[model samples]
Structure formats: structure tokens, C-alpha cells
Target: MSPASTAAASAGPSARRQASGPAFALTAGVIGLCLAASAVPSPLYRLYAVRWHLPTSTVTLIYATYCLGVLASLLVFGRVSDTWGRRPVVMTGLSGLLVAMGLFGFASGAAWLFAARAVQGLATGIAISASGAALLELRQGRDPATASLANVVASALGVGAGGLLGAVLLQFAPAPLVTPFVVLAVLVAVLLLGMTTVPETVPRVSRSGLRIATPGVPRQIRAPFVVAGLAITCAWSIIGIYLGLAGTLAPALLHTASPLAAGLAILALGGASAVPPLVARALPPAVQIVWGTLALIGGIASMAWSLSADSAVLFVAASVVIGIGVGFAMFGALRTVGAAAPPDGRARVMAAFYIVAYAAISLPAVAAGFVAQRLGAEATFQIFGAGIVAVSVGTLLPALARHRAQHRAQHRA
Candidate 1:
């Protein structure tokens, strides 16, 4: 056979991997597993601090380290799967995570944790990038919006489940820190195995596309991408604050400091995140953005007052509102990006989107940790709340003004 004929013959199989109906859910499960595994350390951060005599700033650094690893991986390996094939990259990343679990389980001090988390983050970034793009390709006959919704819902539930799983193990297991990741490892293994059954989604990969580079946005989507980036940056900043402080807030205001109690806020918030996407299944992205931003601003305001007044009910209520807002806002924004993303460049765009998302989640929380140490959690949270409101209003107002002007012009026509 001619070289051209040989290449064409081989290309047929490498080009497309027809997915079963279950592959869609399974792909989303991979994203969920990545998210859940990342949180396995959250409930244990307190344990690490107490056992190691580490300061709050250092604990926050450990958390930030993971985000840093994720960012670095996204920048470098984000597009590797585009050339390397999603199946191999996903499997490789999962193996890295499995090793990270071992590191976390055997860690002797702060340094081990930093190493473990960094490994965990890098692995997660690659896995999430591959799976996210896989979701787009695996949609089969489904709309891109459905795939986006699945991604949001899985992330929400996975985070809640991870925190709760960690806390439960901590509260009941004989050895807290060691037990959580061991259990998590088993879950990761199962998911890793399940992935083998899912067919590869990438069309064809070549050695030339293997170079390390930053994930890039296509110029066509850059405008909507910025608007989407603003939406998530605003929403996730508030989430980062909540995640950083919820443990302390539970004890200070609610008077419950147990490991189980500490995880409740995250669990509740994460659970609430899944609700909006389900309810707003048919809601337009624009409407979702407006309603979601409004909910976030109101929720944060209510939460700030709840803290000052020591009203646990109000705080819980606000958490629900904020969580729903996260669901809607993130879903709306990501859905917009997904729709705009070119099929071939989907993974790169998604990786760029995550870079923005993780930075928003990481930077603000670290800043809040420092502020809270100096000002106290309640006061720090109030300041945090105000900042979210400011960003939300700044984001919401211009969109609203432009929307109104567009509507009037349409009516005049």
C-alpha cells in the first residue's frame, strides 16, 4: 500500500470512538472524581494544623499549593491530551493521583502534604482538562448545553460528597488523616478502571502537537470568554471565601466545632450548587447570569449580617442562596464558553477557563486567610462579603445597561 493509503487506513479507527449511552455519565464521573479527590484534604487541614503545630497561613498555603499545581499543569499539559489521546492522559493522571493518595496517607509533616497536594493538583488538572473536552465530544446527540450542565452538577455534588466523606471518616475512623485518602484511593481506582471501558474521544493525535504551552483562547470566543470569565471569577471568589472560613465560622457563630460540623457548610453549599442547574435546565444563559449574580449579591449581604447578628439560621439560608447562585452562574458562564468553543480547540479553551476559575478560587481564599487572622473571621467575612457585592454589581450593571439598551432598540424597530 502507498504511504498515503496506509495513513488513511489507520486513521479510520483513530478518528472517532463511538460512545455508548453510559459513556456520557461516565465521562462526567471522571470530572466528579477529580473534584472529589481534590477535596479529600479539606477536612484534614485542621488535623494537619493541630498535629504539626502549623500556623493558619501555612495551612492556607498548603491549599493554595494544590491550586498552583493545577494551574501549572493546565498551562503545560492542558493540551497534551489533544495530541496524546484522552484515554491515556486520563489513565496516567489517575495513576499520579493514586500515588498522591499514598503520599498523603504516609506524610510525616507539612512538607509531605505540600508535595502530595502539588502532585494531586497536577494530576487533577490534566484529568479534568481531558474529561472536560471529552464531555463536549461525548455529547453524541446531546446539545453542548446539556454537557455543560452535567459538568456543573457533577462538580457540585462531588465537592460536597468529598468534604462529607472526609469528615465522616475523620469523625469515625481510628486514624483520621490516613483513613480519608485510603478510602479515596479505592474510589479513584474504581473510577480509573471504569475509564478503560469508555472509548477514546480525540480524533487523531500527532507528536508535533505534544509541545508544552499555555492553554489558549480562540480569538472568536475571546469576547464571550471574558464575560464568562467575569461571571465565574465573581462567583468563585465568594465560594473561595466560604470554603476558607466555613470551618471557623461554624464554631464561632454556631458553637459547633466538631469535624463533622466543620464540613457541613461546604457540604450544604456544594449540595445546593446542583439544584439550580436541574431547575434552570431550560433557562437561557443570559437569564441565568442575571439571576445568579443577583442571588450571589443578596446571599453574601445576608451572610454578612447573619454573622454580625450571630444568626445561624440566616447564615444557613444565605449559604443556600449562594450555593444556588454558584450553580447558576458557573453553569451559565461555562455553558456559554462550551457553545462557543471550536471542536478541535475545546480542551484548550476549557483549560483556559479553569485557569481563571482556579485562580479566583485560590487567590481570594489565601487573601481572606491572612485578613481573618488579623481581623477575626466575622469581621473578615463582612469585608469579604462587601468585596463580592462590589464585583457582582460592577459585573451585573454594565450587562444590564447594555441589555436594556438592546431591548429598547429592538422595540423601536
Candidate 2:
């Protein structure tokens, strides 16, 4: 039997007994909530910068700090859920999330913001791994494709909602920073209650202790893994640029002082991101990657031109295009990797994938902040946009070549 079959067989009677009802939707909702909470701070980052008189470099470091915490969690506890039951691990993550939300809501200074974000990252990292695995196992008919699509949609919605909600609260609510987090805290509490009804998909197994190791891709799938990693990394790099810098950048580049404007820009990027997965659900993964990469390249280039020309119309258009490109490319990469992994190793494989992807998301944004401090935001956008274009083009080549080879082989047969 294949490894996936072997893993399913290992689930035994306990797994079958627990596999009834609407667990898929519940798990997916939990995933969405976790991601939304993570994004709640996007609009607030610029406000924090203004309130604390923080430099761009300091702001980026604060953002990257969260990613560091996530990396640490994934490296240490990524596979812990595999040994323990998924529910316990998920609940633990949610508890951590609550603490993070409380910290953000009550934050008084830079230290509080940094600490809150780190805790948020740790909580999100843990929750994402366990929830993603649970979704796969709890999915109706064990459809990996549908599960992957749900994951992508949930992520996009979470990001968009978080940014828009933060914007609205900041504009009208009494306490901008505090109110958004308080709202998220309440939402998370509700999600925690809802999680109680979801079934545990991973059977509890006796293990000696926690196993801490680096997440690794199996040797057989290394080629596709590299392609997927590159695709996701490139796509996330674009997203990181927006998340880390858009709020700050939008005001300066577009000459707008409104927080709502900044928030809407992010919301547009995120909302547009959700479109591709629904539109291209039936396309082959390779086709999706190629088209997505092309869109990424074009979108970045358009943004660069828009910045130079000071065209809000072009900038908005670019954001939408970039969003669609990222959504398609990332979803395709995730589906490819998830489908290739054995059921038992899916979480570890996903953890490994995200470690690389998040690194791409965090590190470059921090670097760009330092560069923007000295060179100016306009120059920085040009430089980062060019780099993204190059990377996307480079990533597209191998995927297209492989697709062509597969087509040729099929034709010959």
C-alpha cells in the first residue's frame, strides 16, 4: 500500500468512529479565525509607528520578530500534534492566541507590541499546523483538493477582513489599537467554543516524548518541492511587502494621510487574492503556477511604473493583479505539496513548506525597511518590485519546462 493508504489504515477504529458530521467546516473556520487574528495588527503597525515615533527599520524588525517566533514554534512543535491528538494541540494554540490578543489590546508601548506579535506568531504557527492537518483528515471523502481550496479561501478572507475591520475601528472607534484586538479576542473566544464540537481526526498514540527536528521534504518529491517553495516564496514576498510596508507606503506614495485609505489598500490586495482559487480551481497545478508567475511579474512591474508616475489608478490595479497572482500561485504550490505528501507526514511537510515561505515573507520586508530608510520608499519599491519580477520569472521557467515535457510524453504515448 502507498504511504497515504498505510497512514489511513493506521487510524483504525477510533478514527472511523470520530469521522462524522460537519467537521470540515468547523476546522476550516478555526483556521480562518487564527489567520484573521494574526492579521489584525497590519493596519495598527503604522499607527504604532506614528505613536511611538518608530523608524521604518524598527517597524520592520517588529514585524520580522513575529515571523521569528513562528519559525521557532514550527521547528520545535510542528510535529507534536502528530503524536498528541489534534484537539489538545489546537486548544493549546487557541489559548496562546487569547493571551496574545489580550496583550495587543492592552499594549502601551513598543515592547508591548513586539511581545504581543511574538506571542501571536507562536500561537498562529501552532494553530495553523494542527488545523491544516485536521482539515485534511476531517475533509469529506478525504478530498485534498477541496481541503486545500478551503484553506486558501479562509486565509484570504481572514486577511481582508482583518485589515478592513482594523481600518473601520481605527477610523470611528475610540481606541484604535485596543478596540480591534478586543474585537478579535471576542471572536477567538467564540471560535474556541465552536472548536469543542469538532472531532479529533488524529488518533491518540502513545509516544515517549516530543520529537524536535527540522521539517524536511521526502527525497522523492524534492524537485517539485523546490518549485513549490520558490513559487510560494515569491508569492509571499509580495504579500510581505504589502503587509509590512503598505500602510506606511500608501500614505507616502499616494500622498494620503488617511488610515482608512491605507487599510483599504491592504483590503483590496487581500480581497483580490481570493479570486484566483475559485476561478482556476480546475486548472492543473503547473498551469496555475505558470500563469500566476506571469501575473506576479506583470503586476510588480505595473506597480513600479505606477509609483514613478504617481498614478493611484495604476497602483490599485497593480494591487489587484498581484493579489490574484499570489493567490493562484500559492494555492497551486500548496496543493502540489500536500498531494505529494503521505497523510502521516502531511503536517511535517506543510510545516517545512511554511518555514521557508514565512522566511521569505519576513526577511525581505525587514531588509526593505532598512533600505527604504536610506534610499526612500519609492526607490525601495522599485528595487523590491524588480527583484520579485526576476524571482517570479526564474521560478516559472522550470515549471513550464516540466509541463511541456509532460505534455510531450502524453502525446507520444
**Number of clashes in every candidate structure?**
0, 0
Candidate 1 lDDT over residue span 218-290, tens digit each: 8877877877888898878887888788878875667777877657878888899999898887876756777
The TM-score of candidate 1 is 0.91
**Distance from true position, residue 374, model 1, in Å?**
0.8
Q: lDDT winner among the candidates?
A: 1
lDDT of 2 by residue, 1-413 (tens): 12446546535444444544456676777778876776677777777888889876677777887889888888888887776767777888888999999998888888887998899889888888878777666542455577678788888788778877888898899888889888988888887887787766765553324556567788988888888898998898988777766776677667878777777888788888788888888887778889889999989998888888888888889989998998888888877776676666766887888788878888888788788888877788788888888999999898897678768998999
Q: Which pairs of residues have clashing backbones in candidate 2?
A: none
- Residue 101 shift from truth in candidate 2, angstroms: 0.7
TM-score per candidate, chains pooled: 0.91, 0.92
- Candidate 2, residue 141: the lDDT equals 42
**Candidate 1, position 79, lDDT:** 83
